[model samples]
Target chain A: MTTANAIRLRYALRRERFSLDVEAEIPDRGVTAVFGASGAGKTSLLRCIAGLERAEDAYLELDGTRLDDSASGLRLPAHRRAVAFVFQEPRLFNHLSVEANIRYGRQRRSDRSPAATFDELVEILGIEALLTRAPSGLSGGEAQRVAIARALMSAPRLVLMDEPLSALDAARRQEVLPFLERLHARLPVPLVYVSHQQDEVLRLADTLIALDSGRVFASGPLEALLARADVPGLSGAAAAAVLHGVAGSMDDEFGMTPVESRAGQLWVAGRHPNGTTLRLLVPARDVSVSLAPLSASSIQNSLAADIADVLPCSDDSAVLLKLDASGVVLFAHVTRRAVAQLDLRPGQTVFANVKSAAVRPVFAESPPGPA
Target chain B: MTDLGPLLLSLRLAATTMLILLVIATPLAWWLAETRSRLKPAVQAIVALPIVLPPTVLGFYFLVFLNPNAFAGRLWFEATGSTLTFSFAGLVVASLFYSLPFAVQPLQSAFETIGRKEYEAARTLGASPLDAFMSVVAPLCRHGFLGAAVLSFAHTLGEFGVVLMVGGNIPGETRTVSIAIYDHVESLDYAAAHQLSAILLVAAFAILLGVFALNRRRAAAAS
Candidate 1:
């Protein structure tokens, strides 16, 4: 497989208590985060994609090459499929030294483009001191780092990580997460990171597949998917909004990047120069609506947007507003009193006044062009 | 009182049994643990039958039926020797049947506990069946191999009834430590019997205790 626009999976598997029925296409691009709760069949879905489980009529294709297709009875064994998997646990062989495990994957490659250089990955994951130790001797985080390096060393077409960080404590997670981010940003292989944590999802994923009870509840670009508050990990007030805009200018006085959107100019605190596409998260609760545009306010910019739709909230009159600002869904959860006071109605134009402090700026650019 | 021939024979038999069993039991146990094939339980039961069966009954079947004028029996005699009835070879055969469970059970449980996830991980990493087994399964379950080895060695060292039935009481050929102790007691040599029995007990205890200590060490490390 030549690696761009890879995996396609459409399959059904019946278990005792649940049936895994998911249809997904993993872009042969950057990280695709599979977000779900514990026991939501996240691991099983990764397993199926990696060719660990056999399902009937399982039509799976990677870069136009059929891995499994019952139409012609073609099933490529996992070893032949060129998919690297990082399991929840490190699963490192106790007998092999750390270098050996890393070399294990490198040795499996038939054609090597750029091997995840031992020194580079060891430095990247900070596993240099662990080279001589066996897996049984390494700490959990250390073992997992070695595991990731090993998977990368193979130079496989796609890498699948099944909750690779859930076992770590918060501090260890923080330590490893940046290395993981670096790995994805640098690696040539497409990565499929399976995680339930929203922070991990937002920090890493370019595309998202939110799994709920053995089904793909939602799957799309991370910006669009994270905008849906009803998506499990993207819930309540915290994980509601993803805003992508192009940098227009840097305002030294206000310390903000003048980001341009279809909604209008947004004053966001970002370090990028003019004309860099960026993605940032704005939680819905952070966004409050003002009927009239305010000039003498601490809030940065007021953009015009039409209310797209509304859904009932806890109270009878209170509702969740889906605002369309240049095709981006910005959720605003306001009480019924405010809704009536603002004279909010679907298809009615209103000023969306948001604060510069409200937007949590993230360094994001478009998918790297195919090399 | 302490002629070391029987002790040497016991060590030889135990070591040989473990070596042979490791080759046979590993794949058998791995398959038993991994496959959902039908007749699995039935096959496992058959392998485990010698553990539960009366030693005399098992010895009776092996001694009489195994050496019949039948085609298999003639072939066995011709390949090895006509004197298969009372030899160290015969004792080794008897010990293998008697000690099968001690080796197979630990290895089977160990292989079972390694779980499908490790194999799945290895498979996705481009390791084939043989590669996964050597690199992943075998190393990950090292304690099981140790337990199986120690159990098989000690079990073979303690073989008495099956050896007596299948391997006649020949001093150098068939007489293991347990058999030698039995001979001393039967001859009214109480002091010699006690000495030989004490040595055997100490050696067996040391082996078993070492295994349990390793098991505890593994458990402690895990916790």
Candidate 2:
């Protein structure tokens, strides 16, 4: 990948018990989710990029600007790097009011013009009522929203969020996820979001960097990474595929929406507006393959798919089949007995049956209509 | 009536020492709170030495170091044409040493309580190190600063051995309240000594009460 419009990082950090050595060029637009387990050195990588943690052997260049280069002995301090970070906890200045906390970064920006005005940020985050309140007085979701606003007001070239919603409970995470989706759609700044939660990654990420034990297991577009069975956590029970398509129309009688992708049309259990772009998540376990289309089954969606690759599952009880419906990729987890009974192979053409209820519409571009 | 000149001098010495110590100890305390250097324990022990060492021992060293014959004293003598021992300037210096830990420990603990989280937050928000400390850290540590200042001032007010050792009973200059009370008792003036002793006793209690109240309120707010 070209380094001109990408964030190039090469860091080798060794701690007593954990070490992180990664070199990857991340795209400079959209949300790049660093998906990993708890100790996968995801936070360490973000810290190194932000200049909060110094690695002895490191070279980081963000959009053609040299932030760190161990060879030349040039390392910009954290404040000068202009890489805003939103930690898991709010970490707001307890002494400052919510408005003052948001302005803390704006007032310190070296650039005179801000990317988004204060009013626009407040509206985006829905934090106008929270402007004058103290940080201590706000709820967990509200504080995280304010933290996001604060990071964006700084006019940073890039933003790093280290599991900003992990500290909150399930309800609070739900509360904050929508605002994040909105920000992802509108903000011009690129974001490096670290999260172990697959649901969050599915909701917000366009690119995926899967880290395993302080190493880069895989890095690519989210759809491609999710389709690969070799990548950890994307197989067996956790296996799923994401499909991007435009909403065709809504069936008012059944309250179902038809989304059209290159793979084929799949009816989803929702009322998405016509012409809206949507991302549908199809779990591998939810799909079943047969030699011919089902004539009497209740499953509403069936597409002709060519078996691309059949790989063994980690549990040995089943096989994960990669299927290509037209050009889109999908996965089907079936038992070995069934795979043999149907004699499914790489070159065989089959019909893939999917329950419309199982095809979940994860994201939509247009603002959600009233309930 | 008991002479008030010594009382005024003692207040002046305490206030001057407290103000100067605030300026000097802030950075030292900040370094102690933030650094991960191997020499941190050694530096902490040195800062706390005055707390454990006998006041006279500290006073004796200060006197010797500031005497006209010593290197530091000789430099001062050459620069100002006046010796450092047995003067009000000498007493302020002695009290600063005597109250070093008082000013440092509170500020250090305060800085530690605030921790490096918010400071790093500020840094990432585009504030320089100094700017972060001023805008985020110093405000959060306001109570610590107040505690340090009050403790240093009150501790200096009650200092007797260090003052007597380095600054002799010079009436209008070096004779602080403690020395005045000591002089009264030595000269069989029990009534005069009682007056000075009671004032020191009440002032110490009030200062301590104020500190405890502030701590209680801070703890409540945090919870």
Candidate 3:
């Protein structure tokens, strides 16, 4: 119920090849990730919001300000909309030095406020060394960092990033993720990030909108939506429930970090400072249904849980059970045979056993909350 | 030694022609590069016609068009109280038509290479359309501008048929280096023809070399 800023958008575009109709209301603070497979209309939606693309009948509002209304014939062009975009390709001006490219956006502000200074952004993005170099000389990762810095420099009402990390290699992606996390924490501007990467969504998103074939399949808090029993196929092969936890104690002797959450204390493979908030993705396939808590087991995290709902999978050979462990929701993907043997039903108490190594920890800047 | 008047006039004519062509060709080329209208093909064909049509054909049409009896010539006479044909201004008019493709094609191709992505990116970054073109598109297409300017100037410098049909051989007023070299050869001035022809050859070679050098550097930087 903590409502401060929000973005509401309704757009329908008809092209020769395909048409997209999507309506979503997202938090206007933190990172709201648009998650979907390629050609799912994710980029098109972002382009419409940025005013780079248009729709016949559309409406867009940010923080209660009406930016576009087709019914009223009120359309703000892209340059006047004050939305910054980070394209997939770096798209840095080859004729400009890194400093000039970053400065391009900053110089366009009507009011010259030092809210986000060039030096500060360069430092945060770790592009200080590249300030004097040309964009052609920088590696892929360095150019992307500079692109992010340039977008941030604009002091925009909202930032739309269209698969910003998709162009980089795995090694380069790892190098730039921390800077993005820092940006998420420090900047007050709302961000609409488009990505199909589950790990990126888990780490950065405060709200999630899943697009499937030009429509919103699901839209809600990242953790709750991913744990839904009704949306079984939405998660695909890597069906997992995201848990928001704080790093508790670092067990260097074992090289594991104990993450405390509503579900239980789970040990993840990492070393982090105490009280650092992180996201953990517990794969549904990694959890096993147990009639009672065993005294000794290879699984280190076992929590008492009550089955909330059970839905059959697409293949019908498996069942996805939504479990409520204390106050947290966890998903358990178990075979239909196991479900029948265990007699799993709604409101029935059981233990969900998860291995210590099954938890994938995500470094998130801010936990999902209203405004 | 060779009077130098014709060489200087040719340079002046080429410079003036390039300046006017740039002012007109930039937007025309940009429109050709970006528009999806049904008329795009027709406009593009008209712009490129000068490249394939024999220079004399264009010169013949210009001769009729620049006559004081024609509408364009009458408009020129009313505006300046002077005749259009057989004047320095007539040569300029003839040269613009003769060299338009040279100015526009390079620019159009250059504009095409920069593409729409960068312009969209600039818009999202809060640049107006004009600002985006000036800041991003113009700089990115610098080589195109260079090629267009050089080719148009060089093409105008050597203009022979169009100048002859439209401006005639009026010394110090319309006769350019090409006409001057022609006059020398017609009068059996072998030494003068060789010297002027060698000068034109060297200038053309140096201009083409510079353009090629620039293209090589751009390619190297891109890779």
Candidate 4:
């Protein structure tokens, strides 16, 4: 009830070109991603919160402790603040070997004890083999992994990552994402990740703070905020709603994995062991709605749902129908003509039509939720 | 025979000048690289003055500035009881000024190469400002330090006009290898002049070669 460990930041920075002024509160557990396009002040916000950039009218508090408050003239220097940053570039000390880079923070940490043990961090990040190697020899993925481990070894209360995966190519990104998910599951410290990638947000973020031109566009639980239709230009044309589900069954013959959620069982083209928690992103444009189920349709997924709400699309030429499937929320983008034909209203039962191919598997965690 | 006095004096002066400049230029170059102050350009221009100013002009100003009657000269006289011109201490002051850009330019460029990201990364990892510089900035800029030290030492070794004006070609007191070579040449002692000049030439070439080799290795490793 006390909102202990919650992070609150309000800052205003004025410069010649871009000025960032934003206020946001994030839960101090799980990964809260600051999602935005480039030049959205994502990195600037992280720098300000880390105390690297001083801002006018700045107020930053973690839980109840004031880390920075311009009104009170209390500003904790970056070194004194228990925040670790994983930069976009690995930024490893080229002079130091991997083992030394990871230990650099630990050696200088104000608290002698670390929140995560060194062995555990190395094992989780899969960096044990790279321990003695110098940073110059590391591939992009390997260097980023070491950078993450190094940040964790410091035992910070918070970790701010500025597009840690942005610099890597696709294959390298795939290589590092699982380790990130593992870190997310294992570490209790809150992580604030700044990224322009939607897939990364859908996969990793528990809370999403969407930014637009240095201001908070919207901030809330990833599921609820991303589903809202009025947030124009959010994630571009591929914008979709995210749903959490548990893997129910896998059929080898069909090469499909059945994911059961409050919205009902949906088949996706993937294979995961039963009981693994999965995150699915169903694009709104991919979904179709009808008053009754299509019996002879090639489209695979059809679920009975009640109309939750109606909101205009960004251009107002269409309407986004919010569907409440059991307790889960799904969005369907339909033409005004379709809505007129269906006469969809709140409390009305309708079939939400979805193609199994459209149900993309975003991410999977072995043991879900913060540990 | 080596006649090792002028040679030793030259080595000692170069070594001492390099050491003092390292101490003085590290912070100044770091500040120049990192500060966003309005006066940054003005400060940078002043630091770069010696590179463009003719050695004779700098030497003339230094001669007047270090005269026992002037402010700095009077202070030096009071502190060390010796006139600034034609003394070993005066030679040191002149060398420091002459070789300053050599010491600072490489360091400033190196600090610039390291950039603010690493420093910020270090700070987030709970390193104080000084701690970050010592641990993160210093090691990362080792190449810069190498370049600066080698260049400063070589530049001091080859110095002629500034040392001549300030040190007054005094043997065993203020005379460096360059001055000694010049004295030998003026007196038509071609053997002595060639001996000292050869040493300077070989030493400068070897130092430069070492620097270039190290830089190439670094570049290759980076690639």
Winner by DockQ: 2
Which residue pairs come into collision in candidate 3?
none
Name the lDDT value of residue A221 in candidate 3: 81
lDDT of each: 0.79, 0.89, 0.86, 0.86
**lDDT of each residue in B1-223, candidate 2, tens digit only:** 5568988999999999999999999999999998999999999999899989999999899989999899988898899898789989889988888898999999999999879999999999999999999999999999989989999999999999999999999998899999999899999999999998998899899889988998899889988
Top model number, TM-score: 2
Ranking by DockQ: 2, 4, 3, 1
Model 3 scores a C-alpha lDDT of: 0.86
Report how closely model 3 matches the true complex, as a DockQ value.
0.84
Can you write out model 4's per-residue Cα lDDT over B50-153, one digit (the tens) per residue?
Answer: 88999999999999999899999999999999899889899899999999999999999999987987888888888999999998999889999998899888
Residues A197-275, candidate 3, lDDT per residue (tens digit)?
8778877787888877778888888776777644423453456788878999899898888889988888888798899
Better of 1 and 2 by lDDT: 2
Q: Could you tell me which 10 consecutive residues in candidate 4 chain B have the lowest summed lDDT?
A: B1-10
Chain B TM-score list for all models: 0.94, 0.97, 0.97, 0.97
Measured against the true structure, the TM-scores of the candidates, in listed sequence, are 0.86, 0.95, 0.94, 0.91
User: Residue-wise lDDT of candidate 4 within A81-179, one digit each (tens)?
Assistant: 888899999999888899999998998884657878889999999989999998989999999999999998997888899999999999999999988
Model 2: runs farther than 4 Å from truth?
A: A110-112, A252-254, A295-298, A365-371
Identify the runs in model 4 with alpha carbons over 4 angstroms from their true place.
A110-112, A235-239, A249-257, A268-271, A294-300, A314-318, A335-346, A360-371
Worst 10 residues of 1 chain B by lDDT: B65-74
Per-residue lDDT value at A320 in model 3: 81
